[model samples]
Target: MSNSSTGEIRIFDVNPALDRAALAEQFSRNRRIQIRDVLTDESARNLHGILARETPWGLAWHAAEDGPHNIRREDLATLSQDERVAIARKLDTAMRGTDYGFTYAQYPMLDAYLKKWSPGSPQDAVLELINDQPFLDLIREVSGIAELVKADAQATLYGPGHFLAQHDDSHVAEGWRLAYVLNLCNTDWRPEWGGYLNFYREDGDIEQGFRPRFNALNLFAVPQRHAVSYVPPFAPPERLAITGWFRDR
Candidate 1:
């Protein structure tokens, strides 16, 4: 779909060459697979520009019993230097221990659409594209889950020091059927930079891990053990993506 006022910018066009049967076979064997170059070149570049330059980022984190905080960009800017440091320290402490914790930047796409935030922006266009018939059919074919009727999205950025602790997505009551990450990182992203999507074995070993690759779509059945690996201080500033779950309801 073209979102530009001049009608020249196409924002969410999926690649026409994807092999659905092959992807479905892979998913059937392992319940997860990453499709590279999932979007057309023009579309991917346009979407990346939207994430890197147009979106308003916010802080989303949880440290012990303190919070499952969703602080907007404006609110985040109001914090004192010491307050920012304290929040970082608390996140570090919680993550180091045997407890649930995460710290990352996000722009809730669905929420923004419903709230009329940034109307006509590329973010809203992308969300609408996700729920449109073509994209939904693609997801259904790859997952072999015909019941997936809708999706929710959040634009996420995992800059230096960000991480997500491991947890199984067992929210069955919420109708979550599959989890997807539409990676939008730079093509030059390196392994040492971290920010990998890792799946764990029962013995705590990493069963599999997928690096953040530009324009790649990673899909996995929900209720699985997984986490986003920490991005170290030395890593680059942007590990951007659109992430969320596909639901039956």
Candidate 2:
């Protein structure tokens, strides 16, 4: 597996049809499964590479989130060890406290983190790496509520003991819609590590979790119940992929 971030190209240039086909196969295998894993060794590693280098930032989060939040800490099996370490360092810097703000602006629909760590920073470069072929393909394929024309993405570099509480991504905009992601972190993740995407069933009784697997896309509707599982203070760093949604104006 190779790093998914090394290449540069137009966001819309990559062929999404192939990606859409691949997802259809996965869906056929597991219909209606709340959480699924999609990234291969190479794809996962590639995700880790991009995420590691993203700029860090202080997002806005309210004590009381209006809707639901779903987090899937993706892994990067396709990247080199050295590259993975580099991304971890950035996450360490962004996530300093046990629970820090995760949204650039306060809204039930959107929140973000980046290696650069500031608003209105350099985004085109990051977007170039983020909108990889498969990742973009999956976002385009996952069908349902319309609004999010494209996924709203940014790396959530959770540093030592850093965590994002529960929240929602509904009505981020008229385009704020579906949620999907291509995880780009290393594969050596653990349970005690505390960075799991906690999903609450509509019933609000049975809450389950989806581990952030590499290359996997978590596509779900907005206004759903969820949260970013805890990331215990890892020494160097811990990270994963974050992306989602297709919108219609």
TM-score for each predicted model, relative to the true structure: 0.95, 0.56
After aligning candidate 1 to the native by TM-score, how far in Å is the CA of 97 from where it should be?
1.5
lDDT (tens digit, per residue) of candidate 1 on 1-249 = 532211478767778999999999999999999999988888888889989999899999998887889888999889999999999889878878887899999999999999998887778888988998878988999999999999999999999989989998899999999999999997588999999999999999999999998999999998899999999999987799999999999
Best by lDDT: 1
lDDT of 2 by residue, 221-244 (tens): 565566766565562365555554
Q: After superposition, how far is residue 34 of candidate 2 from its true place, in Å?
A: 7.8
Q: Candidate 2: TM-score? A: 0.56
- Pick the TM-score winner: 1
Cα RMSD for candidates in order: 1.8, 10.6
